[model samples]
Structures are given as structure tokens and as C-alpha cells.
Target: MIRLRTVEGDPPDVDALVGMYADFEADDRAQGIPPIGTDLIRGWLTGLEGIHVVADHRGEPVGHAVLVPVDGETLELAIFVHPDYQGATIGTRTLGELLDCGAAADATAVELHVERSNDAAIALYRKYGFTAEETRSMELRMRRPLVTPPVA
Candidate 1:
């Protein structure tokens, strides 16, 4: 069974999370992230600031999601699941939990950039209410409002 947990403040078990990213298939990377080398991945993960969630199976991280503050009311979102754990709803669950964390943080919106060629990721983001805001070269910028606008 997969269990989801929030990593509050300082990230815990970063080595384990790095291991998962290390094993991630290069072909699956989007927007040049989850950087290619161990040192790069470590640097990227450590520099991230905001809400974080980890999907663990038998105490090992198989998926990770984060919402980094972009501004006072918006956050940038990113999610990744290990290749071996893909297609098993790990991404779905991890995303849901991360969004919940975002809501708790009082963030009003979230945005992400995805490779245009990644149909599955685009579909998943759409399913969660992200709408295309712009298309830049080979990437699509998507955004979703976390708070409902008051009827005027």
C-alpha cells in the first residue's frame, strides 16, 4: 500500500527522495527538471521552498510533489513519480495531497509548466482543473485557482 505524508519545514529523508529521482527515467523528465546528475538533483531539491509531500511504499519514497511560493497568492507546482511506480495512481494521490497542503497555506492559485509532448501529464493537470494559460515554444503553462471567486 502507498502512504502519503507531508514534509513540513525542513525536508526529511532527502537521500531517499534523491534515490527515487536518480532512478527516474530520463525520457520522463519534463521541462529539464529532476536534473540529470546526483549533485544537480540534490541542489534542486534542497533549494525548493514550500509545501512538500512524499508518496512512500514500505517506507521508501516512490513519488514526490511540491508547491513552491511564486508570490503572496500563487505557488508553482511540480510532481514526480518513480518510473516503477507510474500508472498506479501514485501521482494522483500525491498531487491531491500537495494541493491540500497548498490550500492550508492559503495559496490562491498554482501554476506549472509541462512539456507539450507529455500528453499524460497534460491530461492529469487538466483533470485537476488546470487551464492552459500560455504556450511557450515546446512547453505549455497551466494554472489552476485554488480558491473560489466570490460571486459578484
Candidate 2:
């Protein structure tokens, strides 16, 4: 079973996540992400700021999603699922949880850049209401508005 949860104040288990990325398939990369080496992956993960969620199976991370602030009211979103865990709805659930976290944090919008060739990811983003904002070379930019809850 896969369990999903937000990463709170404490830092995430970087080594475990690195291990997961290490096993990531090269063909699965999009827009040059999930970096390419141990140090690069660690640097990228540690430098990210904002909400993070992890999908764990048997206490090991198999997927991750994040909503990083682009400004006060907007955020940039990214998600990745280990190849072994793809096509089983983990990406969909992880993305839903990440968006929920973004809405709860009061973000007004979220954006992402994906390779134009990544049809599966683009379809998933569109399913969640993201629309194409621009196309730059091999990448496509997409954005979606988040509806925050009413203030009490």
C-alpha cells in the first residue's frame, strides 16, 4: 500500500529520496529535472522551498510532489513518481495532494514547465485544470488557478 503525507517542519529523508531518484529511468526525465547525479539531486532537493509531499510504500519514498513559491500568490509545481510506481495512480494522487497543500497555503496559482514530448504529464496537468500558457522551444508552460478556502 502507498501512503501519502506532507513533509512538515523537519527536513525530509534526503538519502532515501536520492536512492529513489538514482533508480529513476533516464527516459523518464522531462525538462532536465530530477537532475542527473547524486550531488546534483541532493542539491536540488535540499534547495527547494515550500510545501512537499511524499508517497511511501513500506516506509520508503516512491514518489514526491512539491509546490514551490514563485511569488507571494503563485507557486511552481513539480511531481515525480518512481518508474516502478508509475501507471498505478500514484502520480495522480500525489498531484492532488500537492495542489491541496498549495490551496491550503493560500497560493492563488501554480505553474509548471514540461517537455512538449511528455504527453502523459501534460494530459495529467490538463486534467487538473492547467492550461498552456506558452511554448518555448522544447518546453511548454502550463498554469492553473487555485481556489482557496474562505477565511473564517
Candidate 3:
């Protein structure tokens, strides 16, 4: 069974998460993420401040999703699932739960940039209501509204 847990303002098993990245092949990377080494991975992980959700399988973290604040009230989304764990519908569950997490935190909306050629990722985002707003440097910038407009 897969379990999703929120990691907000809390430290997670950084090593396991980083290891998942290391296991990814060159072709599996999106936007040059997961870095390359332990130090770079740790650096990237440490630099973010926002909501994180991890998918635990049995005892190890098999996937990760994060929502980092971009502009005030808007968050940028990113998700990575270990290569071995891909195609099991884990990405669907992880991202869906993260959106729930975002709504709980009162996020105005969530945005993500995915590789233009990554149809699978784009489809996943589209499945959750993210619309492609623009394309820049081979990446598609997508956004999904999470909160209602305040009474004006």
C-alpha cells in the first residue's frame, strides 16, 4: 500500500528522497531536477520552503511532491516519482493529494513548468485542471486555480 504524508515545516528522510532522485536516469529527468550528487540534491532540498508530500511504500519514500511559493499566494508545483515506482498510478495520487494540501493551506493557485515533450507529465497536470498558459525555452508553464476570488 502507498501512504501519503504532509511534510510542512518538518524534516523528512532527506536521504531516501535524495536517493530516489539519484536512481533516475538521464531521460527520466524533467527540467534538470533531482540534481546529480548528494550535495546538490541536499542543497536543492534545503533551499525550498513550502508544502512537501512524500509517498511511502512499505517503509521507503518512493515519490515526492512539493509546492513552493513563487509570488505571494501562488505556489509552484513539482513532483518526482522513483523510476521503479512509475506507472503504478502513484503520480496521480501524489499530485492529487498535494492539491488537497495546497487548498488546505489557502493557496490561491498552483503552477508548474514541465518539459514540453513530456506528454505523460503534461497529461497528469491536465488531468488535475492545470492549463497550459505559455511555453518558454522548451518548457510549458501551467497553472491551476485552487481558491475562489475574494469578494471585491
Candidate 4:
């Protein structure tokens, strides 16, 4: 069974999260993109609201997703699923939950920068209704309209 936990602060599973991201970077390098090493990931972690949501299976972290505010109305999402857990619909669910995070921030939209050549991720984003708003030779800028929460 898969479980999703909203981490209130730094997750206790930081090591596992970093390992998953490292594997993702290797995947990127395999497809001809620059390797995003631990330094970049570390820098990003520091600037983030230090929030994380972890997906676990049998007491082990299998996926991780984070939301980072980009501007007044935009939040950037980054997700990494352990390679062994790929193709299990985890990415789709993780992304959907990430989108929900925007609502809590009072965001009107969410955006993410993805490699133009990463067809798998592009398809996943499209499945979640994210549309390409702009593109460069190497990257695509995608956005999704946020779901507004009802006033309490």
C-alpha cells in the first residue's frame, strides 16, 4: 500500500529524499541534460519554505514532492520518485497533491520548468492539465490554473 504524509517541517527522511533526487539527476544526464548535482538541490532546499510531502511504501520513502513559491501568485513544484517506484502512478498522484498545495498558499496558478526532451514528465504534466505557456530550446514553461478554496 502507498501512503502520503504531509511533512510539517524538514522530513526525517531527508537522506532518502536526496538519494531519489540524485537518481533523477542521473536520469536527466542519460538524456543529454546537464547533471543537477547535490549542490543545486541543497540550495533549492534552503530557499524553499522547508516543506515536503513524502510517499512511503512498507515504511520506506518511495517518492517526494515539494512546493516553492516563485512569485506573488506562482508556486514551483519539484517531484522525485525513486526509480523502482516509477510507472506505478505515483508521479501522477504526487503531482495532483502538489497542485493542492497551491490552494493553501492562496495561489492563483502553479508553474514548473521541465526539460523539453523529457517526454515522460511532459506527458505526466499534461495528464494533470498543465499547459505549456512558453518554451525555449531546452526547457518548457508549463502552468496550471489553481483551484480556489472556499472561505472558512
Candidate 5:
């Protein structure tokens, strides 16, 4: 089972998050920039609500995700599953939880900038209902409508 929680900032899993992101960035050198250290990752996490969710198996962290709010109405999301857990649906579940939280907070939409070369992520986002609205350089801007509350 996949369990998710809204982590405010700097959870114990921050190290894991940083490691995965840094590794991914290293693997794709031209995709923006790689996180150099914990300090930078912490600084980035500090600016937003830092929604972090972990999927555990037998009390071990196997997958993790983070959603950084871009503004009042937009958010940037990233997820990483340990190579051992890559084929599972942890990423999908994490994305769903983030969207639910954003909708609950009255956000109208969420957006993410993903490198076009990252076909797996692009495909995953599209599977989760995100639409590619534009592209710049090697990055693609994807957007998804947040579920809105009914008019009172």
C-alpha cells in the first residue's frame, strides 16, 4: 500500500530527496542545474510548503516526492523512486496526493517544467492528465487543472 503525508519542510527524508535529485541531475547534465549540496536543497525546500511523501515497504523509504509551490496558483513537482522501486506506481500515487492537496488549498492549477529528453517523466505526467502547453529550450511546460470546490 502507498501512504502519503504533507511534509511542511526539512523532513528526515530531505537527505534522500537531495541524493536522488542530485543523481538525476548528474545523469542529465544539461537539464537546468544539479543540486550541489544539502544546503541548496534545504534552501529550496524552505521556500515552499515542501510537500514530501514517502512510500515505505517494511518501514524503509522506497520512494519519495516533493511539490514546491510556485505561487498562489501554481506548483512545481518532482518525484523519485529508488531504482529498486521504479516500475511500481509510487510516482503516480504521489502525484495524485499532491494534486489533492493543491485542490484542497484552492489552487486553480499546477504546473511543472520537465526536460523534453526525460520521456519517462513526460509520459508519466501525461498519464496523470497533465497537458503539454508549451516548450522552451529543452524544457516542456505541463499543466493540470485542480479540482475546484463547488460554488456556495
Candidate 6:
């Protein structure tokens, strides 16, 4: 069974999450993400300053979703599901839990950039209400608004 939980109050399962990314194939990369090195992985995780969630199956991480603070009020969103666990409901659950926490944290909006060729990911983001704000080359920048905007 897959279980999803927020990474909080502790160091988090960094190794397990790293293992998931390390297992990724070249085709699974998104705009050159999940960078290819232990140092890079650790550095990326260490720099996160917002909500993060992980999906675990039998104590091994199979998916991860995070919302990192950017431009003060906006958060940058990212979600990854290990190839072995793709097509299951893990990504949806992980993203849902992270967004729930982000909302409670008063997130005004969250943004993500995904490759245009990745229809599956685009559909998933759209299902969560992310709309395109810009498109450059092969990447689309999408934003999901959580709170109402103030008057001009």
C-alpha cells in the first residue's frame, strides 16, 4: 500500500526520496530536473523552504511533491512519481496533501513549469486547477491560485 505524509517536524526521508530520483530514467526527466548527482540532490533538498510531501510504499519513497517559497507569497510547485509507481494514485494524493498544507500556510498561488510534450503531467496539473500563465519553447508555466486577489 502507498501512504502519503507531509515532511515536517523531522529531517524527512531524504535518502528514500533521493533513491527514487536516482532511479529515474533519462526519459523521466522534466526540463532537466531530478538532477544527476548525490550532491545536487542533497543540496536541492537542503534548500527547500516550504511544504513537502512524500509517498511511501513499504517504507520506500515512490513519489514526492513540494511547494517551495518564491517571491515571498508565491510557492513553486513540483511533483514526481517514480517510474515504477507511475499510473497509480500516489502522485494525486501527494499533490493534494501538499496543496492542502500550502493553503493553510496562506499561499496566494503556486507555480510550476512542465514540458509541453508531457501531456499526462499537464492534464494532472489542469485537473488541480493550474492554468497556463506563459509558454516558452517547450515548457509551460502554470499557476494555481489559492486566495482571491486584492483590489487594484
TM-scores vs. true structure, each candidate: 0.94, 0.91, 0.93, 0.78, 0.74, 0.91
What TM-score quantifies how close candidate 3 is to the native fold?
0.93
Q: Taking the tens digit of each residue's C-alpha lDDT, what string does model 3 give over 21-47?
A: 778788878777878888898888888
Q: Tell me each candidate's RMSD, in Å, in order.
A: 1.2, 2.7, 1.6, 4.0, 3.4, 2.0
Off by over 4 Å in 6: 9-11, 149-152
Write down the worst ten-residue block by lDDT for model 6: 7-16
Give all candidates' CA lDDT scores.
0.88, 0.87, 0.87, 0.73, 0.71, 0.84
Write down the TM-score for model 5. Answer: 0.74
Query: Higher-lDDT candidate among 3 and 5?
Result: 3
| Candidate 6 residue 71 C-alpha distance from true site, Å | 2.0
Q: Tell me, by TM-score, which candidate is best.
A: 1
Global lDDT of model 3: 0.87
Tell me the lDDT of model 4 at 55.
89
| lDDT score, candidate 5, position 73 | 75
Worst 10 residues of 5 by lDDT: 25-34
**Candidate 2 deviant stretches above 4 angstroms:** 8-11, 148-152
For candidate 2, the per-residue lDDT at 149 reads: 63
lDDT of 4 by residue, 79-107 (tens): 76777888887878878777776677678
Question: Could you tell me the C-alpha RMSD of candidate 2 in Å?
Answer: 2.7
Off by over 4 Å in 3: 150-152
Clashing pairs in 5: none
> Against the hidden true structure, what lDDT does model 2 obtain?
0.87
